[model samples]
Target: MPIIVTPRHNSPEFKEKCVRLVLEEGRTVAEVAKEMQVGRNTLHGWVHQAKVMSEAVNRAVEAAVAEALRAEREESDARAAADRAEIVRLQAELATAREELAKLKGKG
Candidate 1:
């Protein structure tokens, strides 16, 4: 005859803490599960869920950083355009002033 085992229910908080002990506290899943009196497979599943959640958060952060970089590049391009226009205007004014000075010297 085969031995039958009953399934145990654990709260969300309990599962989270157990997963944290394995991930953050450097404890093994088998060790934690053994200490917590839970099944090793169940603890492993919690750890897997935690890893998936962490990867999702990392992706979100990377996307946000990429967006910020893009916006910064756009602002920089706008500033460069404005600076180039100013430089062109200043050069034209300088050329006109030089021409006037040359004409006045010639008249003298």
Candidate 2:
């Protein structure tokens, strides 16, 4: 059996800095990889994460999106409920009117 060991990574801040440089600073992944002495695939993955990963600054943006979706769904549900209520009310009214018409015809 052979034992395997993984290389320890740089600090988070360093990783963040490099990722940000590759992503936000428009640095080429290959260039960053060469600078960091890491594989291009590794640098590309870091840059991709930097671009997509949600951060504290983006928390409000994500929350606003969730709230907007919830509000839109709530509005749709409320409209559907209102339509159902209106249908029931109209049906009951129709039944009552029919009964009254029958009573009037009997009196006539």
Candidate 3:
């Protein structure tokens, strides 16, 4: 007689599908578990784990956005400072040109 064996661990894709069926289809864990031949508690645990992972992913995304914004702001500030320096340099050059013109006029 051949012995029967069931796998102990479910694949991540299967776990995701089971979680989605319960979450997206508005089905009860027990109902989905019964249909899928999984233990009710195991399905419930999968759902809980999915929710936790979703929250963690959301937090990570928010943090990344904030970091990107901070870096953009710093870059903008640096550009603005460079612009101000260029403007000051141009103003000083104009002043020197004006001073030279005044001296030439006085000498002429």
If scored against the real structure, what TM-score would every candidate get?
0.79, 0.47, 0.84
Worst 10 residues of 1 by lDDT: 1-10
Runs in model 3 deviating more than 4 A are: 1-5
Could you tell me the C-alpha RMSD of candidate 3 in Å? 4.0
Output the better candidate (2/3) by TM-score: 3
lDDT of 3 by residue, 1-108 (tens): 322224633677778888999999999998898777788888899999989999999999999999999999999999999999999999999999999999999999
lDDT, candidate 1, 1-108, per-residue tens: 322233433677878888989999999998998777778888899899899999999999999999999999999999999999999999999999999999999999
For model 2, how does the per-residue alpha-carbon lDDT over 52-91 read when each residue is reduced to its tens digit?
6656549878899999999999999999999999999999
Superposed Cα deviation of residue 10, candidate 2 (Å): 26
lDDT of 1: 0.88
Candidate 1, residue 28: CA error in Å? 1.3
Global lDDT scores for all candidate models: 0.88, 0.77, 0.88
What alpha-carbon RMSD in Å does predicted model 2 have with respect to the real structure? 9.1
User: C-alpha displacement of 84 in model 2, angstroms?
Assistant: 1.7
Cα RMSD (angstroms) for every candidate in the order listed = 3.8, 9.1, 4.0
* Candidate 1 displacement at residue 3 in angstroms: 14
* Predicted model with the maximum TM-score: 3
lDDT of 2 at 89: 100
